[model samples]
Target: MSGPRIDPSLYRERDVVPIRRALLSVSDKTGLLELGRALADAGVEIVSTGSTAAQLLEAGVPVTEVAAVTGFPESLDGRVKTLHPSVHGGLLADLRLEDHERQLDDLGIRPFELAIVNLYPFAQTVAAGAPAGEVIEQIDIGGPAMVRAAAKNHANVAIVVSPDGYGEIRDALASGGTTLEQRRRLAAAAFAHTAAYDRQVADWMAGETGQADRVLRVEATLSAPLRYGENSHQRAALYTFAEGRGIAQAEQLSGKEMSYNNYVDADAAVRAAYDFERPAVAIIKHANPCGIAVASAKAVDPIASAHIRAHECDPVSAFGGVIAANRTVTLGMAEQVADVFTEVLVAPDFEDDALAVLRRKKNLRILRLPADYRREIREFRQISGGVLLQTADSFDQGVNSAQSDSSAWRLVSGEEVDAATRADLEFAWRACRAVKSNAILLADAGASVGVGMGQVNRVDSCHLAVNRAGARAQGAVAASDAFFPFADGLDVLLQAGVRAVVQPGGSVRDDEVIEAARRAGVPMYFTGERHFYH
Candidate 1:
C-alpha cells in the first residue's frame, strides 16, 4: 500500500524557493486577480484549470491551461482536467534529487515552484440545504490531490490554500521568493484545510446514509486562548465550529476578554432567557441559573421589568452574575444594571442609550449576539476517557412542549387553578430546565422567586427553594425537574403553602405523593417528562 520512498540524504534542504512556474486553481477568487498579476509581472508561467484560466486571461494575465501541459482535452465535465501525471509530477518533483529531475526531463514536464488551490464549496453547499446530487457534485477530488502533493513536497514547492496568504506570498516574492519557513507554515495550513473539507464530506455522507454512529469526527478552529480557565492552575482555549453560530461568534462591544467561566455561565443564561416566548432575562452564577423571569405581555419596558423581577429572586447571588436577555436591552434596563456589579451582559441587541449607559462601567463585559444566533440540537460532554453525545434538553418534546400548552398536562390532585396560576406553573417548568439537578423552582406572576439546584437529595432542594422564597412561597407555584420518589419532597413544598405544583410523575411512590397533595388541598400536575440538566 506504500509508495516509493526516497532516502533523506538524496535531497538537499531548501532555504528559498523561487517561483519560476505556478499552478493556480481556486474556487474562491477573492485575491486571484491580484496574485495572478504579481506572478505574471515576475515572469512566472501560470498554468490554470478551466474557470481559473479564463479569469486570468480576462484580467490580461498570461495563463496556460492545464490541458495544454497534459495534452488532454477537458473531459468528464472538467472533473479530469488536472488529474494527469504531468500536473502532479511537476508539483512533486525535487530538483535536488537527480532521479526526479531526470524523470521530469524525460517526460517533458516542467517543475512547478508554487501551487495555489482552494477546494470547492462543499461545506457551504451542505449548509445551504442543497440536494444530495448537488452536494455530491461539489466533493472535489482533483483539487485535494494537487494540494496534498504540493504540501508533501513543501521543501521544493510553496502551497497557498487561502487568499489570506496572498499578501504574504506577494511580499515574499518581492524579497526574492518564499523562504522554507514560510512554505512549511503554508503546508500546515493547507493540510488543515483539506482535513476540514474531508470531515464535512464524511459527516454529511454519514447522515445521508443513516450511519452517523459508525464514526465520529468533531472539528473546530481555535478562536482564542484565554488568560486562564476556571482557576489559574488550569489551561484553556476557545475553539469554534467553522460554520457555527453561537456565543463564540458573539461580538464583544466593551470591557476585558471573556474567561472560561464567563462563557459557560453566559451560554447558560442565554439558553434560560430564550426558553420563554415573552421578553425575559436570566442571571447565572457558576453555570447555574440563580434567577429567570418573563415579563407580562402588556408590561411597558418589558425587558427592564423582567430584569428587575429576575434580580429580585436572589439579589445577593445576582450581584456578580452573568445576565442574558432574550430581547434588546433598553435604557431602562441599562440604568438598573449599572447599579449592580455584573461580570457580563449578552443580548440580541442594545439601544443606543442603553449601550452608552453601560459603557460607563469599564469592567462590565457587553456582548451583542450574532444576527443568525440559534440553539444547537446536539450536546457534547467530555468524560474521563470518552465523550458523551445526546440530544440537547429542549422544550420541543413531551406534554409541556414549545407551545407551553397546559392542556396536555394531567392534573393528579386538587382542583385545577385559574389561568394566571396555570401560566405560572408552565413558566416554572420552563425555567427549571436551566437549573442543575436535583432542581426546584418557584414562580409567581411569570417570575422566578426561588431556585434550589445541584443538591444531592430532592428533600434538601425543596427546603432550599422554600427558604429562598420566604413569604413568596405562600402562593407561588413550584416545578420539580423530575418526579418525586416519595412524599417527603412534596410535603416540604406543601408546608411552605405552595398553591400549586408541577412534576413529572413516574415514581413508585407517585400515589403517596398524590395523596399528600390532595390532603394539602394544592393542585399538582404530572408532565410525564423530566428536564434534568446535570
Candidate 2:
C-alpha cells in the first residue's frame, strides 16, 4: 500500500533565493501597498488575482492578471482564478531541480520566487452570525491550495500569510533575497494559518449539519508568556481562543502582569459573583471563594454594601485574594477595597473616582470585563492521558430547572422558612456550586458568613464551616453541594445552631439525616440535584 520513495539527493538544496517574480492574493490588504511598492521597485514581476490586481494597478504598480498568465478567464465568480495548473506550476516548481525547471520551460511557465496570500475572513464571518450561505461563500478554496503549494516548495518559494511579516519580507528582498531559514519559518506559519482556517470552517459546518460531537478541533493563539505557572520553577503561558470575551480578553487597566494563579482565581471570582442577579461580590483565593455576598434590595450603595459584607465573612482569608464584582466598582467600594491587600479586582466597569482610588495600590491588578461577557457552556479539563469535557455547572439548571425557585424545593423536615430565610437558603445554594467538592456554605442576610471547600469528607467540611463562622453560624442557613451520606455531617451543622439546611437528598441514609434535622428543630430541603465541582 506504500508508494515509491523518492531519493532526497535528486532535489537540489537552496540557501537564499532571489525574488525575481512574486504572486499576490490576499483578503486582508494590510500593508499590501507597501509590499507591492517594494516588489515593483525591486523590478520583480507581480502577478495577482481579482481585487489584489486591481489595487496594485490603482497604486501605479505594474501587475499581470492571474487569468492572463493562466490563459483562462476567472470564472465561477472568481473562485476558479488561482486553481489552474499555471498558478500551481509556478508555486510548486523547484527551480533547483533540473526536471522541474525543464518542465516549466517546456510549458512556457515562469516560476514564482515568492507568494503572499491571506485567506478569506471565514472565522470572522461565522462569528458575526452570518447566514450559512454567506459564511460558506467566505471559504477560500484557491487561496489554501496556492498557499500549500508554495509552502511545500519553500526551498524555491517563500510563502507569506500574515501582514505582520511584511516589514521583514521587504527588508529581506532589499537585502537580495529570503534566506532558507526565513523561508522555513514562513512556511511553518503559512501552514498554521491554513490549518486554523480549515478548523474554523470544519467546526462551523459540523455544527450547522448537527454533527458537532463527531469532531473536535481546538485552536488557540498564544496570548502571553507568564512569569511562572503555579510555582516559580514551572514554565507557563496563556493561549486564547480569540473570541474577544471572558478573562482572556479582559482589559487590564492597571497593576502588575497577571500571573498564572491570578487568572485562575480571577476567573473563579467572576463566575461566583455573576451567578447572582443582584449586585454581588466574591473574594476568592486559590480558586475557592473565601467570601461572597449580594446586596439587599434597599441598600443605598449596593456594590459597596456587597463588598463590605463579603469581606466580613473571613477577612483573614480575603487578604491577598482576588475580588470580582457583578456591578461596576464605585468610589465607596474602591475606598474600602484599597485598605485590603488584594491581588486583583475585576468588574464590568469602574467609575472614574473608583479607578483613581484603586490605582493608588501599585501591586493591585484592575481588570474590566468585556461588555458581552458571559459564561461558556462547555468546559474542558486535561488529565494524564487525554482530556475531559462536560457541560458547565450552572445555577439556571438547579432544582426544578428553574432559576432560584424556592417553590421547586421539597421541605422534608420541620416548619417552612419565612421569605427572608428562604432567600438566604437560595443564595447559599447558588453560591455553593462555585465551591469545590465536599463543599459547605453558611449564609445569613444575603451574605456568606462561612465557607468550607476542597475537603475530603463532608463532616470535616461542616466542622470547618462552623469554625470559620463562629458565633455567626447561629441561625445561619447552610447549603451543601452534595447529599449527606450519613447523619454525622448534619449533626455537626445542627450542633452549630444552623437554623436550616439545603442539599440534594438522594443518599440511602437520607432518613437518618432528616431525622437528625427534626431532632434539632431545624428545617431541611432537598433539591434533588447535586453540584460537585472538582
Best by TM-score: 1
lDDT of model 1, residue 124: 89
Q: For residues 223-280, could you state the per-residue lDDT of candidate 2 as single tens digits? A: 9999999999999999998664898889999999999999999999999999998999
Q: What C-alpha lDDT do the candidate models reach, one value each?
A: 0.92, 0.92
Q: Which ten residues in a row have the lowest lDDT in candidate 1?
A: 396-405
TM-score of each model, in listed order: 0.95, 0.88
Candidate 2: Cα lDDT at 106: 98
Q: What's the number of clashes in each of the models?
A: 0, 0
Candidate 1 structure quality by residue, lDDT tens digits, 203-291: 89899999988886777889999999999999999999876888998999998899999999999999999888789999999988888
Residue pairs with backbone atoms closer than 3 Å in model 1 (clashes) = none
TM-score of predicted structure 1 = 0.95
lDDT of 1: 0.92
